[model samples]
Target: MWHIWTLDDWEKNIDLERSGHRCGLRLRFDKEVDSEVRRACKEFAVFLRREYFFPIRVVIYVKARERIIAMDGDKCCGIFWCMPDDYTIEPYIRLAAGDYEKLCKKWGKDSALTNILLCMAHELTHYFQWINSIKLTPIGKERQATNYADYVLEDYAETREHP
Candidate 1:
C-alpha cells in the first residue's frame, strides 16, 4: 500500500500553522521509487499554495495502488480524483507503478518527477474550477485541467530558470 496520510495526520504531526496558512497531507513512496519525485511533489504543493493562493493540504500516496502496472495499457499515465467541498475539494492522485517505472526507464527520473507534478497540478486545478463554479462538460473539464497543469508547469519552469 502507498504511504497514506490524512489532513488529521498532518495536523497532529506537522507544524500546520507554519505551513503557510495552508495544510498539506503527504504520501510517502517506497524505497524502490526515486525519492526526488516525492520531493518535487511537496515542492509543487508549496508552489501551488504560495503562488496560486490556494490553501491546500497535499496528500502524497506512494505505492498505494493495488495494481502496480497500468491496466489500461501505457496510454494512461495516472489518475486523479477530486471531491469538492464548500470551501475546498480534496484531490486524490495516483500514478500507476508500471507507468512510473516505464517513464523512469525512458525519460530518466527527473522527467518522471516533472510529469507527476504536472499531473497533480492539472487535477487540482479541476477541483478549483469546480469550486469556483466553472461550468464544463466532463471532457471540457479534463481539457481545462490539462491546460491548467501545462500553464502552471510552464510558469514554474520559467520562475525556476530565472530565480
Candidate 2:
C-alpha cells in the first residue's frame, strides 16, 4: 500500500508540509523508470487532486513490463471490502515507451509523451473506480476507464498545458 513510502519515498512528502495545493497522493518509482514517466506520475496525481477530488497515494514501479501497460496492485482489504491505505500503480514504463513509439508511427502526429500520458491516465481511471462504490462488468469496466481517459485527455488538453 501507500505506506510503502520508505524514508526515500517519503522525500516527496515534503510538499505535503507546504502551504497550498500540496497533494496527499504519493508517487514512487524505481531507477528503471525514465524521467518522462516520472514527471507524468507527478502531474497525474496533481490532476486527480485538483480536478476529481481524489487525494490518494499511488506508487509506480517497474517490476513487470511484459503483460500489460499498467496494473493497480492494491489488493482488496482483508477485513473489509474497501481499498487499503495506498494504491500500488505498477506502470509498465518500458512497455509504455514501446507503445508510444509504435503508436507514434501509426498516428504520425502524437508525441511519445502524450501517448504515455494517455496510458497513465487510463490506469488512474481504474484507480478512481476502485475508490468509489460503482461496479461494472469486465467489458463495462474497460469502456468506462477508456472513456474517462479519452474525455479527460481531450478536455484537459483543451483547458490546460499538460506535461
Q: Per-residue lDDT of 88-113 in model 2, one digit per residue for the tens?
A: 33211222342434444676433555
Q: CA lDDT of each candidate?
A: 0.56, 0.47
Could you say which candidate leads in lDDT?
1
Give the Å error, residue 112, model 2.
Answer: 2.1
For candidate 2, report its TM-score.
0.54
Segments of candidate 2 deviating more than 4 angstroms: 1-23, 62-110, 159-163
**Model 1, span 48-130: residue lDDT tens:** 65665333554545553323334445344455555544334455556544356667789887687677777666656654564
Clashes of each: 8, 1
- Candidate number of the best TM-score: 1
Judged by whole-model lDDT over C-alpha atoms, candidate 2 comes out at 0.47
